[model samples]
Target: MKAAHAAWRGLEPVHGMIYFVPEARRRYAELGLSGRAGYFTSRSAAFGRASVELVVSTFYNFNPDLVRRALDGAWDVTTPQHVLDARYAAADEALRRAGLHELPALDEVVALTRRAAESACEHAQGRALFAAHAALPWPQEPVLRLWHAQTLLREFRGDGHVACLLSEGVGGLEALILHAATGEVPVDFLKASRAWPEVEWADAQQRLRERGLLDGDSLSADGVALRRHIEDRTDRLALPAYAALGDAGCERLAELASAFGRAVVRAGLLKPG
Candidate 1:
């Protein structure tokens, strides 16, 4: 479990840097996408002009209105292939800027992560986002391939996490509120980013309090226990993907990926939280 968490922590920045880098925004701007449209469109483009409801269902935790605003008529302006190409191009430029290409043992990290991602593909029965990405052709370049591999793994884990949330009867906004209660992310940040109304946020908080999972803005003992259970279940669901690496391989991947992820953070490619 520790290895799984560590590996994800290391790889998260590797895959997540694309969203925060200027290169991604520039590419999206070239296609006339502004504000948060690039983010919503680029991530969901694999679904080929996906519906608002579909994005809401798969993204799980964003306000549906926000999803609709970003996705509506986005495909009319750009094709999914073009969006995917731009996304890959942004990742390529971002990685190059981070100097990940010059890192030691780059091939080994790529190979290990790719092996795990492929293994994840085999268990994609309930992983919509991962399965969508798995159907795409592999990138030929090592750096981009590394990004794609981590992207797959991230989405694989994300889909499983969504399932855990659903199984626990936690809705999209409730999940954000719970996460905020954990003190890892600010409630304001989650609320603003997800475009949830203040009233809805308050209502969700009240609901959580009624259920004994929250006390005011913080988690009660029951809340802490439930959050732990959700995360533990999510980790267990994500384990099959990393099982291909074995414990030793996972630890090695974690070590290598942590160095690379740190380099990316040092390069200022990732946004400050």
Candidate 2:
């Protein structure tokens, strides 16, 4: 089980870097987006083109009005399929540019990823968070299937994370505060990226401190323990997808994908944390 969890986490960067890599951002910009804001806005437009409220409700943690502002006229710039293609292309180019395009193990990773994603999709039945993505069409290309699978896996866990946070009575700002306190992301980046207001951010800090989750500017010992518990719970919730791979399969997937993930990291395709 632990190996399965590790395999999923290990492969995360291979697909997840598209959102943060500068090359990918450039690709989105080429698609008529202004910059990162346009990228996130147009990319996350996958929750159906209804209204900002619908996106905000499903997305969570992001400021509502900021979501509205970012998504304003997003569809006019690019469609979801186009955005997905560009993201995939960026990853593809980065991998190729890094000389990984011809790697022998990549195809194995893709096959394993697709299988894992299929298992996850089967398990995703009736899951509200995954329903939106599950309803989307799958690509025939092996690499694209890998990306799609990772996306579903991410959303599956993301939706679970939101549930966990909500159960703890935390919302957007508080969630950011807790994340910052955990030292996973800096407070400045959290505030700026999420467009959190100063007054509300301060209030959230006070609230976290009251909950014994914040000590000065860091997470308290108790806070660390609590956050670990939440993460562990979320991991357990996501176990079924990995379970389909079985223990040996999980280890092999991780072993095969680790090099590619490392290449992505070394190429600076992901931001330094």
Candidate 1 residue runs with Cα over 4 Å from true position: none
Off by over 4 Å in 2: 125-129
**So what's the TM-score on candidate 2?**
0.89
- Residue range 7-107, candidate 1, lDDT tens digits: 88887998998888999999998998888899999998898877888888998999999989887778888888998999999999999999999998899
Q: How would you encode candidate 2's per-residue C-alpha lDDT over 1-273 as one tens digit per residue?
A: 677777778778876777676667787788787744554654464555546677778768877877778777877867777776777777667656655566678678777777776777777654565767766777666556666777778887777777787777778678778788777777788888788788988888998899898899798998888888888888887777777778888899878877877876787767832
lDDT (Cα atoms) of all candidates against the true structure: 0.91, 0.74
Can you give the TM-score per candidate against the true fold?
Answer: 0.98, 0.89
On lDDT, the leading prediction is: 1
